[model samples]
Target: KSTVINALEDLSFYCMENLPFDLIESALDHLTREKNGPQRFAIGIDARDKRFVKEFKNLTEKLRKKFRLDVLFLSSSDEVLAERFSTTRRKHPLLDVGGELIAAIQHEINLMQPIELAADASFDTTLWSPHYLARKAEERYSGADLHRKLQVTVVSFGFKHGMLKPADTIFDVRFLRNPYFDPNLKHRTGLEPEVAAYVFEDPATDIFMEKIVDLHSFLLPAYYLEGKHYFRIGIGCTGGKHRSVALAERLVKDLAAKKIPNVELSVSHRDVMIGQGI
Candidate 1:
């Protein structure tokens, strides 16, 4: 809980950990009274705190009456939780009560049942990477900023490697001239100036990119207005090293140049190093 609070503090959120249930109201009052108090705050409580867990609903109601609050509950399958404990070699809080690791996990899960039922939102972290989980948490708690913002993740992938999942939009750049055919560019990636020039210099490539940009420019705003929070755009080619990477880069640049308000862009070349030796 201290670790989580520290991380939130680093992100500029005023944080408190393990405030007793009885003091929550006073804590809020004190925070709001400070001249330099943070507009955003995070309070962390362990699920193992049975007293707090039992009173969570009432506490949540009281807090909601005073401020906009969100309850984010994170959990994972038993197997995943066990694996995490194994990898970290950390003792579970329930282990202090005298039980095996799996038994401790089950005990904790049982204790958290009521809180889970009362959560405003819940996430299963079984398959999520740490970075992905952090990104998701930030996005979820961004509050009012989410109303005006749309996150765009542009991914460049290779057809041979497999399709990217969870893509809101996908563009195939295979029809564009292949840079792999040129021995000079075969070993180079689209990030290289020579490879990028080769991929984008074709008239057909220009027309394709223009069409894609036009479509996205038209659709992105509509999606945002319709309450879409995140958009994933996948660009694919025979191999992710060249055409897809160049086009994804160009698309991100064009989107940024538009200066579309509240739109954040991120790009990744998923298969850029598929054949490169680690």
Candidate 2:
């Protein structure tokens, strides 16, 4: 559900994650009273939120009458949830001291049964990747703003920082030249022209991009046709300071140059200042 919430945030919705259930009405009241507050909002709720069951049981009907409230219950098979926890090596939110993984997953499911029964919509995301879930979320919750063009998010990350979650496509640029080896360039990032120029000076860089651009040109139309509104491409290198960032930026530029119909592009370098303490 974090993936879906993040997708809404990209669409300019004011988001509050894991908010206390009892504060829902008061929070909306305050947000509405502000002079220039957001018109759209996405609130994230789960079994772990304070007084979650109590609020749902006591106030869902009242809140729905007062506002255009929606409860989108997201669930997955217990096996899938267990596998994800193992892969990410993260504890389940509901895990108790000395509890087993499967037990924790089952416990959360049992606890949230009431909310599931009351949800206006429910999505079973057993096979969905994070990016795919993000796209689905936008389609499900964006109201009437559904005719917007396909949006692609290009993200640059470092392998050392751990693999980026929720990426649709990931490209490793570690084979590219190492700007970290150059004293003058080590402190700089790919956002700088000098670092970018240095990284792309390799003849193979352009050749690789040609194939990548071609591949996406063929793939994006299919995604758009299927009603997907969001895609994320992850670029990774050893440090994210140079090669990955440079390649990601180049990819954005190359795609923009294509001017593919009904497409919008944006880029972010996720770990550009990790070790620099900037």
Candidate 3:
């Protein structure tokens, strides 16, 4: 439930966990009537109940007349599940009746087979991290508008924390002057105007920005033509608190100013507060 809930948090959907199979219709009805309520809803169900699987499918079909429905089944290898359970030191819900953990996992898998077959989409999380899984789900659930447009995510990170794997392009800003060397600006983050100004004051920063923006402007349409919907660009420096963040913000601003048709832009600072004292 946490996995599903966390993944959907970034989207506009309102989520309910551990919803009884019987109440799905009621929930949908309530959502539809509310003036300001979210049109998208994510309901979580426990797959351990074999009796509800068929009934749930029936309910989903009935609800489809009223709303768009996309059923996603999430699963993983037994070995991976076992490893997760072992690492977390938590008993499986099906561990009752004196069954071994592996047996319980197998039993649950058997019960989930019907739902898996009926699912519109399925994901195997054996090798996926939670963030990556969330990204995949978001991509899968994005509206039709997103299909026509390229969604660009510009992320700022510190090299010490490692590179962002999902990045389609990575730019290093370590060559810029270090703000950390100055006592007054050492603790400031790039979101602060002073820090941003200091970071962008270098002549090299201007040249770099122009080149990167020009490259993206040239490449974005090509990627769009190739049917690519999402692109993650990474900006990294020694500490994410300063240069990377400033550059990422500026880049997005520049891109937005260009008004690239059918392009959506977003930014995130992944490690901005890593070493902050307060």
Candidate 4:
């Protein structure tokens, strides 16, 4: 619901002295409201100083009744933070207080014993960026226990890169008739419904579609067994300008028509006018 620290100085005495207290108060108030009103508990435990552990523990104890606490404790080694501070050209909290920055960090880590022991999850944030943290949080929160629908993303790409990483299966359309050779349609992408019509004019394309759809219908239930949250089926051609792109768009439409749930499909051309650098 909310976070309550010992004091602003608990993070970095030097750092907080320059920060606006109003902002901190507002954040705490927001956290409190979320915890008490919505049963949402979001708390961050950073052992920047040794004294804040008491307040952190007290806050958790008080909010246990209303909110389900998701406590995250971010830890780092003294050596790592020291190197980071040097690289960033930033002053350490204890540098001006007759204390070694490394010593202060060690002291903080030592004081985190209680919180770490009590944490639901602990992460080493020394080498992690904020983006990575957010992703980790999302992955942890996305509950897989209750009938998680298998997500399928059918992406169209170029053979130049081989395949997209998330693709569970790949289909090649390089052998099919390509629309890129047509001067009138060369500039267009697969998103235009006309492109799809032009590419699917070949009788072989029609046969291939019927088969692929049949195959996918059979494979989806099997894929669910592997705990696959998302499936990216790549369709690639030589340049991805016409065949691959058109096929991808058509695949999404067909999948929709068949009433496939948990399927989020998209089309991409890795190269459209790449040779001319357009």
Candidate 5:
């Protein structure tokens, strides 16, 4: 989401200053777009006859409530249009026995003024390449997961320094004794059974883990109802080598063991480099 905002801010500088200001305004308005971030939009290109252009324009306008819409109005010169229509033998929207194909195209363009003016951008397809047209459509309206599903990023960070910058909750395991002081186990990591045993054997560690687990067990369900799809829970200890790592691993295991399907869990050690047996 932040990436989208940053990209828009960077693009805003290249926009024309005198335009009706929708593009620039939309870019700037990104800051206030709310929980799901920027609104989803779509680009609509109608290649039907201008005869029904008015009706099509109205239909596209009605789509605005469902999606931010960008309409492209394509036309060609009268001579060129007539040559193509005659070659293709297609009926014109406002055609008559003596009607000019060019005139009908112009009339369609004129009738589409309301939609064009409301559009984020407009272009003449005759002058744009197919690749360029596709790119333009993408630029005006392209977003993955158009439904904007919540993005839950599972990150592992060491707690010795501080909680993660974007973390909503933090768990502390500092009460567990330091395995660094155990001469026989000092060189081992939290992944080793020796270190794990030392940490898990402590009564305080047991109580702390239970309480923290309960807290998460309570809070996660509430987040689901609030439409939150992302959350980072940080686990920290004095050095992030023993207690923190062990607790983080345990949390991951417990959550996984329960088969908590939409939730994500990961663990990382922040200060695993601290000298052993210190």
Candidate 6:
């Protein structure tokens, strides 16, 4: 369970481990009001909390109505659990004074029945490695990128609006040709064909794309091997209406190439519609 929670944190979820069930709704309200809180969240509930186990269904039903939820119940065999506690030389949470290890394991399993039965998914981890379990947890929540290992977020923003927020890397397409100066293309965004054509038509953009593609082709796989969960790339321009947006699209296309395996790609034009009636 700790491994899974850590994996969710690596995926940029704001995680609360061993969170008491009673405070969950109020905690979510607090997260919503924070100036820069995470939109994604993962909460770990302790089965040892008797009230939580007794009220699991009601609390989860309330949570589901207000927020999207998935409950993952993780357990191992009694023998394996007993061995783990013995190896760690630690007392079991359910163990009574001078109680037997196997007995405590069995008792906890019985206590966890209500939760395991109600969970969205349940996994028996007697033979599973922590790495394998963490990977499984990441894959379960990472969306349709089952075949990929890294998530890449490419966002285009205007320096005029603000510096791109907390990206892993940023590229200034401000050096590329500006479509804002063109009378006809001035009102258009890079999503339009003419603006995209004008931006990509620049010889400098072709060289820039080549260098970027070369750099990330190596960087993406290196980061994946380093066990990175996600990468954010920011593309900035003087005004996000044109050049940055166009190059961002082109970069997404280049990133989709077969050479970049196990990479999930997505792009956002952050300030594209700021001045427009969007």
lDDT of 5 at 206: 77
Residue 120 C-alpha lDDT in model 2: 66
Superposed Cα deviation of residue 84, candidate 5 (Å)? 37
| Model 2 Cα shift for residue 209 (angstroms) | 1.0
Q: Using TM-score as the measure, name the better of candidate 4 and candidate 6.
A: 6
Clashing pairs in 2: none
TM-score of 3: 0.50
Model 3: how far is 182 from its true place, Å?
85
Q: Each candidate: what lDDT?
A: 0.80, 0.83, 0.82, 0.62, 0.56, 0.82
Predicted candidate 2 versus true structure: per-residue lDDT over 133-189, tens digit per residue? 998888876766545688999999988888988998899887877888888988999
Winner on TM-score between 5 and 6 is: 6
lDDT of 1 at 115: 84
RMSD of each: 10.5, 16.0, 13.3, 13.2, 15.9, 16.5
TM-score of 2: 0.51
lDDT of 6 by residue, 1-278 (tens): 77899998988889997677678889998997898877778888765677888888898787776665677899999888888889889878768822887887888888889889988788889999989999888887774533446889889888888899889889988777778778898899998999999998889999999998888888887667544668999998877878888889889998897458778999999999972321
Query: How close is every model to the real structure, measured as TM-score?
Result: 0.50, 0.51, 0.50, 0.47, 0.44, 0.50
What range of 10 consecutive residues in model 1 has the weakest lDDT sum?
Answer: 1-10
Model 3: which residue pairs collide? Answer: none
Q: What is the lDDT of residue 149 in candidate 6?
A: 67
Evaluated against the true structure, the overall lDDT of model 6 is: 0.82
Given candidate 4, what's the lDDT at residue 186? Answer: 74
lDDT of 4 by residue, 53-88 (tens): 666666555444343345556666789877877888
* TM value for model 5: 0.44
| Each prediction's number of clashing residue pairs | 0, 0, 0, 3, 1, 0
Identify the candidate with maximal lDDT. 2
Error of 5 at 204 (Å): 2.1
Ranking by lDDT: 2, 6, 3, 1, 4, 5
